[model samples]
Structure formats: C-alpha cells, structure tokens
Target: MIRLGGGPLERIVAVGAHCDDLAIGAGGTLLTACRARPGLRVDALVLSGGGGEREQEERAALAAFCPDAELRLTVLKLPDGRVPAYWEEAKTAVEELRGRTEPDLVLAPRTEDAHQDHRCLARLMPSAFRDHLLLGYEIVKWDGDLGRPTAYQPLSPGIAEEKVRLLQEHYPSQRHRPWYDREAFLGLARIRGIECHARYAEAFHVTKLTLNLGD
Candidate 1:
C-alpha cells in the first residue's frame, strides 16, 4: 500500500452540519492529532444548533477533543435539518472561514452522507477550499449509509477509548439515543482498525488527493 503524508499540520478546519457530528465522526483523529501536536490550531464551524444547549454542548466537546490546540468554534442558528434552505447563509459562513485561514487539513462531512444538512455542507466545502486536503468524516446512522472510505487515521486502543469516553462525557443530550452507546462507537472503530491493520481507527472518504513522491 502507498501512503500519502500531509506535512506539518499546523492548522485545520472542521465543519459539521450539527453538534456532535464532528465528535462522532472525527473525534479520535482530532484527539490523536492534537495530542501529537500541542498548540495546534483548530477552527470549527457548525451550521446549526447555535444559541442553545446544543451549542454549549459542542463548545465543551470540541475543546476537550482538541486538547491543547488554539480552538475557535462558531455555531450558527440555522434550523436543523434545513440547511439547504439557508444556502446563502451557510455559504457565506464557509467562505468567511476560508478567508480567515488556509488550513493544512479539513475535516468535514462526506457528500454522500444520508443526511441532507451534512450533504449540503459537504458540497459547499470544495467550492471554498478547492486545493486543500479535505477529509470527509462519517457518522453512523439508521440509514445504513456507511461506505468504503479511501483514507484511514489509525488510533491507538487508548485513544479510541478516550474518544468514546469524551463523547459520553461532553454530549449529555445525545445519550438518550439508542445508537449512542459505547458499543456503536467502538465497534465501528474496531472494524476500521481491522481494515487498516491497527488496533483502532477513524476512516474518511477523500474525494481528491495529490500525491507527492518527491522529497
């Protein structure tokens, strides 16, 4: 297998359609990266759930997930499950974030996601950050929308456990869901780990990647 390395990840942008999306999809990756690179810059944007309890949940969750990074998050008030209707507002938010930082990596939803809000943001991302390494993170749902991902971020057993722990700790609002349990998170990680020959991992769909074989 050929490995592609993205050098010196000083900054990253993580966008989500709603609260808990980032934590569910990319929390382990965020924990692993932030631990390895202390003081990393993490800029996050959530299209909905602002000015409410969910926003509070997201802020606390991301802070814990990013660890020592300089984390800045924006949660908007757009109605949940209705992001496409607010296209102009969502587009402006993404564009403004683009104007602020040229991130080395971007963590976002996959265009093929079953959720409309997630798909909307995923489609909007490429328009703003055309040349960046954008990793489309996945959220398991009742729709059975999991796909074969092209990229893997291997997480240690400890990191995987920590990710689950943090998810449980930070997002109290999500606990009532039947699917929001330890088994669901760890089981997915275990499967992805088996695929990548690791103890655990987070998988991502890469729409495009540029390989540089030269030093």
Candidate 2:
C-alpha cells in the first residue's frame, strides 16, 4: 500500500442528516484525527433533530467522539426523513458553514446512501464546498446501501475499541435499535480493516480531492 498524507489537518467540518449519523459513519476517523492533533477544530452541522432529546444526544455524543478537539455543532430543526421539503434550509446551512471555515476536510454522507435525507445532504455538499476535500462516510443500517468505498482510514485495535465504547455509552436512545450492537459495529470495522490490512478501519467515498506529491 502506498501511504500518503497531506492537508492542513487543523480544521474540519462534519455534516450529517440526523443525530447519530456522524458517529456511526465516521467516528473512528474522527477519533484518529483528533487523537493525532489534540486541539483540532471541528464544526459539525446536522440537517434535522434539533430542539429535542435527539439534538441533546448529538451534542453529548459528538463531544465524546471528538475528544480533545474544539467542537461546534448545529442541529437543525428540519424534519427527519424529509430533508427535500426544506431544501433551501439545508443548502443554506452548508453554504453558511463553508463561509465560516476554510476546512481542510469535510466529513459528510455519501450520495449513494439509501436514505433520502442523506442523499439530499450529499447532493448539497459539493454545491456549497466547491473547492475542498470531502469524504462521504457510510452508515450501516437496514437499508443495505453500503458500497465499495474508494478510501480507507486504518485504525488501531485500541482506537477501534474506544470508538465503539464511546458510541454505545453516549447514545442512550440508539441502544434500543436492533442493529446498534457491539457485534454489528465491530464486525463492519473488522471487515474494513481486512480490506486495508489493518486490525480495524473506516471506509469513505471521496468524491473530489487534490493531491500534492513532492520529491
């Protein structure tokens, strides 16, 4: 495998359609990033589930997931599973985030996601963040929409365990869900790790990226 790494690695913008989306999809990557750089700045935006317990869970969950980073999160009040209806609000939120931070990276939902809200958010991301690197994170759910990701973030055994622990501990509401179990979470990570030759890993679909190779 050809190892490559270069980017500001300082600021990041993480967007999701719902409360636990970010954690379930890219929590390991976020853990890896923040652990390497203690004070990384993360600006998180979600299109739905604000002004409620779900929003509360998001705030606490992200804080735990981000670790030492300076995290700022926005949970919009747009109804869940109906993001298309509030198209303007979703677009405006991403644009506003773009205007505020020149993020070195944007962690967002993949366009191929089976969920309508996720698809809408993915479609809106590129329009707002025209000249930035964006990694489309995947969420394992009943939709069975997982695809072959183009990129991988390898995680250590310890990091992988921590991610699962934090996810389970932080999101109390999600515990009742059938798929939200240790086996399901770790199983996917283990599979991704096999693909990347690591003990555990997270996969992503990078739609656009600028490479800087040097001598």
Highest TM-score: which candidate?
Answer: 1
User: Which ranges of candidate 2 are over 4 A from the true structure?
Assistant: none
lDDT for predicted candidate 2 compared with the true structure: 0.91
Alpha-carbon lDDT of model 1: 0.96
What residue pairs are clashing in model 1? none
TM-score of each: 0.98, 0.97
What TM-score does prediction 1 earn? 0.98
The C-alpha stretches of model 1 lying farther than 4 A from their native spots are none
**In candidate 2, what are the lDDT values of residues 1-215, reduced to their tens digit?**
65667556999999999999999999999989998999999999998889999999899889988889999999999998899999999999989988889888889999999999999999999988888889999999998999999889999999889889988988898899999999998999999999989889999998778777654
lDDT of 1 at 78: 97
